[model samples]
Target: MPAFDLPRRLVAEALGTCLLVATVVGSGVMADTLTDDTALALLGNTLATGAILVVLITVFGPMSGAHFNPAVSLVFALKRDLPRRDLGFYVAAQIAGGIAGTMAAHLMFDLPVIEVSLKARTGGSQWFSEWVATFGLVGVILAGLRFDGKAIPWLVGLYITAAYWFTASTSFANPAVALARSLTNTFSGIRPLDLPGFVIAELLGALCALALMGWLLRQPANNTYSAARHS
Candidate 1:
């Protein structure tokens, strides 16, 4: 059984997600304000998000595994690390926290409480990019958990920072983040209409990674001859 209760874990997930999305949206807003250059704005957004991921994960990982993304939670649930019964609560908290974070960003910038994003992020390349980004994200998490658990925070943070530039959709690998970002007409926002594709791609990508990792991590068959020889 897990050390923390469901409610406490839920709170940690919510708070961590809220802070994470706030960092993403707020940084994007500030970056947009500070520069006309898209690359520079993206750089600022990437740095702020990456830095916050490291901090949030370090602080909240012990309590709830710091799964701010619903996709990540789903992966854990599939792996049976997270209770199947608790999956709904975790997803709810992540989505709610994501929305709240977007609202908080708007409030911080003196914008309206809610705004539908006009930014259209759709295309074959964009969808494919989301798939690749999410696949890499989950793959990194699974591999890191096996190899170097202590460095997961940095690994995730840095991976996201790099994915932001490499992926065409700027690597909104989290379903909740993609949905929440659709509410803001800012540098990091995506149109509501464009969100479904990204969400689907992300989910598929995560699922694929889980399946692949499961196969890859399986134990090798024991060799009867070798065992007899050793005996």
Candidate 2:
């Protein structure tokens, strides 16, 4: 079957991103409330987020590469891989998805619209942390694409798992997630004031990944083009 068109892809990104943010952030808040210890909550949150991503990628990756993050799509565009015309569509979808997801989470969690708990950057080292976190995330995606993308889904899970701990900002590098998280002050909330900095950092990270992907994807003789054919 033919791949989904640009508009369809955007819709998928929007819906998928919304779900992703809701699950991740909601789990975090839920973890805080469980009678169980914080560790258990954290574990539950991580697993929930990871599992959802795997399913989302499997379901939507083929249609739109499941690029639930605007940074991811922009990176692909920078690489000349994505159709330039569709860039805006994908971004719009992701933004819409992010907001919608937060709205759903608010209702599900019984929290007001202003209480969404999103992960995000703060002052001081938090700025640098966002950049690094985004860099790592985009790197993972770009590198995965260079391969067969067979392990990408699994890798994404592992990546987020590690990112949750290692990065100072708790690795909330997803722009869609960030936007959705801003809607609430619950476990997933990231300060609205902090968003611009995060977005700038995320865009830079994606750009860096694009440069790396471009350089690495250069096939030698007989190697031909892998991504070209796939695209």
lDDT of 1 by residue, 143-220 (tens): 999889899999999999999999988999999999999999999899999998999999999999999998987766
lDDT of 1 at 89: 96
Q: Give each model a TM-score.
A: 0.95, 0.87
Cand. 1 Cα-lDDT? 0.94
Superposed model 1: Cα runs more than 4 Å off = 221-231
Query: Scored by CA lDDT, what does every candidate get?
Result: 0.94, 0.78
| Model 1 TM-score, all chains together | 0.95
Cα error, candidate 2, residue 161 (Å): 1.3
lDDT of 2 by residue, 6-116 (tens): 677777888899889889767877887873585677778878888998888888888888889888888777666788778888888888888888788778888776563
Q: What's model 1's lDDT at 34?
A: 98
Best by TM-score: 1
Off by over 4 Å in 2: 35-40, 116-120, 221-231
